[model samples]
Target: MTWGDGDGFVTCELGHKHWGRYGAAGLLPYHDGYVLLQHRAKVTIGGGTWGAFGGARRRGEDPVAAALRETAEESTLDASEVTLRGLMHEDHGGWSYDTVIATAPALLEVRPASWESKGAAWVPVDEVAEHNLFEPFAKAWPRLRQALRRPVLVVDGANVMGSRADGWWRDRAGASARLRDQLGAVDRYTGIAPFDVAIPEKVLVVEGKARNIGPGDTDVRVVSAEADGDDKIVETAASIVAEGPDVLCLVVTADRELRRRCVAVGAEVTGPRWLLNQIAPKAVDTPG
Candidate 1:
């Protein structure tokens, strides 16, 4: 109920002690082939070992905000320097430590700015294990490394809108906006993907009348295609995959030709059914 009320130690079901009364979180800032790591102060738990920038969450703080706040306090970087991709959780019975794996638009200079952090550096993914690592982090590194790339889901606004029998054709922009709002819930929906994922990046490509659906604060990003929606979707996916980072680009649509083009450029294709099905309970017209 007060600031830092989540601070302090508690043992997990496995009889191992962990910091934070509430679950803790860490910010994993990644760019290119490197990820930021912080060397812990010798006086702290798992001292002198390297891990992500993070610590105790304050009372009522969400994991992502906590991670970012901790990262800012422990390092010279600010929240503006990174874009959050998704959250990954390491559960220990009732306790858990969530990792906020984010994508940095570009690598920024970093330095240890707090006593809790002894040093900071951007370590190449392959060299992470060579450093003295926090025990828990060492164990989680391999699996986490396998998922370092961000996933982007490019939705065909028209295609998904058409799939529904709602009176969408009469109001394409409203339908597109409705679809965009519904997509914000996708991050909380699970079990559809084959593997665990951080929240994937979502891009909604709208054309024709729906093209009027401009950008706003919705979880879904609207890209008004200057021409064909399919071409724009494919181009967007191709540009993302071409970045050369470990990334998954999924163009959401049932159009066979669009699917072929997207997949041809190292992207994946999924029908609108998967997304619509997952967010069904929220109702397409309902705000996310």
Candidate 2:
């Protein structure tokens, strides 16, 4: 086995020995009510037990990047095929472990590509507890199960544009396009109250004059409304919630009526100011 800088056991402040000197991370890829897990080889730690495909992180590597690299080394699956959802961190005083959550479009075939794994399988979520699980993974499974779903941020373009006093009344389409572009450039977010992290599936709903705005060169999905913007927003939230139980929809709008309407369809409501604060450098003092 090739040894890396982080590949040794170290006792943490909690007085527990961990495998990595820097830290460790694991990948949890879910799809269609199932999760991909690895069966550890007899010679490895937690041998013969099921756990995430992972290992010690390389020095100074980002947790997400480490998780992806470890998973790719241990299995046939590649990181590019999956969409990163969010992250769950477990701090052991001086040491830490990050569980990187992701979603696959389909149940892609994966097999053990390294000696560390005895096998790999896509196990149904309901049946996970039935397996002989690794100790730490077993303890974290319940919380991780509850957090499997990804957050989808639905932005009400007209409502949010109105909130900003940046002279958006002149050209609504230009304002909408600007919003879309800003949402794309965000690498991370702060003050996302509902979730621990904010890597989300962004949807911007534009209406009336703003409906003609082109889809910008970002990952944000722009939904144009034919008539009433509020109606379209409600419809969009309902359709997304219906997609699966794992989806967590958070609508960004200050419209009281619209907030109540979105809540009726099972979406959590936040304000436009929170969205603006995340994408822009300057803080918004206006009320959402």
Candidate 3:
């Protein structure tokens, strides 16, 4: 079923078959290494505990969309101010909930204006352990801590090319070449894609005519190979996974099969729109 269609519940056999019955999106607003967290109000479920700003998904909405919407409603933080990082978890059982973790550019001054939250404040990553946290959040904190340190964006040049209506098919090679150049330029525009923390890495995989592009001095590294770019992406992702648990890798592609492959190795997947929407005009110079 689609994100918001149906009752939206999945069964998790993790025991007791706990029923959360809701999908959620959490904003891990960060600025200069600090994260924004909320202290649940005494009246709310899991109240008086620390957690990211989030809530139940509305019917007919995607979990990520719902999460961003809830964050704005609860804290008055603009949804456009945040950049989706990836999914942190999916808790399902008789009931189901998807955790969409996004990053914000600053340690926003968030207040608990909504009935669901009692208080909200910015908390340093090192200090998160000091707060009384919701059980699930507490359990996920360690992993989140690691993820916050390294954020990655993977591009499937071919799939993205198909998604763009810019007349790319007429000149596949030229389109891919231009895309590579644009991405390279983007990597150098430090403030264009604004992030709470410095992005450690960006990987772009190109196939066919685009296979010869190489890494530049910018934050992006281009990998072109004889094998399918999708395979190369998965391989690179697997290599990153081997570096330990502190890395956050996101795969960008509209290919379903590629998405499944990335997920198998713990990489997060997002469609081309997510990337295109974030593209800044200042990053690339084009013919008018």
Ranking of candidates on lDDT, top first: 2, 1, 3
For model 1, how does the per-residue alpha-carbon lDDT over 1-288 read when each residue is reduced to its tens digit?
123788888899888898888879898988999999999999889999999999888777899889988888888987897987766778897578888788888778899988889999899999999999998889888867866777778888999888887788788889888888888655743432422545787888999988877766676778889887888988888998997757877788999998999999999888887778775654544532
Q: Output the better candidate (1/3) by TM-score.
A: 1
TM-score per candidate, chains pooled: 0.86, 0.91, 0.54
| Candidate 1 local Cα displacement, residue 45, angstroms | 0.8
**lDDT per residue (tens digit) for residues 123-235 in model 3:** 88899998899776787787667556456677888887777777777887777766766665643112212222233357778888767756544446777858767778899
Compute the lDDT for candidate 3. 0.66
Off by over 4 Å in 1: 1-3, 184-197, 216-221, 224-228, 277-280, 284-288
TM-score for candidate 3: 0.54
For each candidate, the alpha-carbon lDDT, in order, equals 0.82, 0.87, 0.66
**Index of the highest-lDDT prediction:** 2
Listed per candidate, the RMSD to the true structure in angstroms reads 3.3, 2.5, 11.6
Question: Cα lDDT of model 1 overall?
Answer: 0.82
lDDT of 2 by residue, 1-288 (tens): 246788999788888888889888899999989999999999998899999988888899998888998898889998899998887778898788888889998999999999999999999999999999988789889878876887898999999988888778988888789899999888555445333565788999999998877676888899999989899999999999998898989999999999999999999999988888889758465422
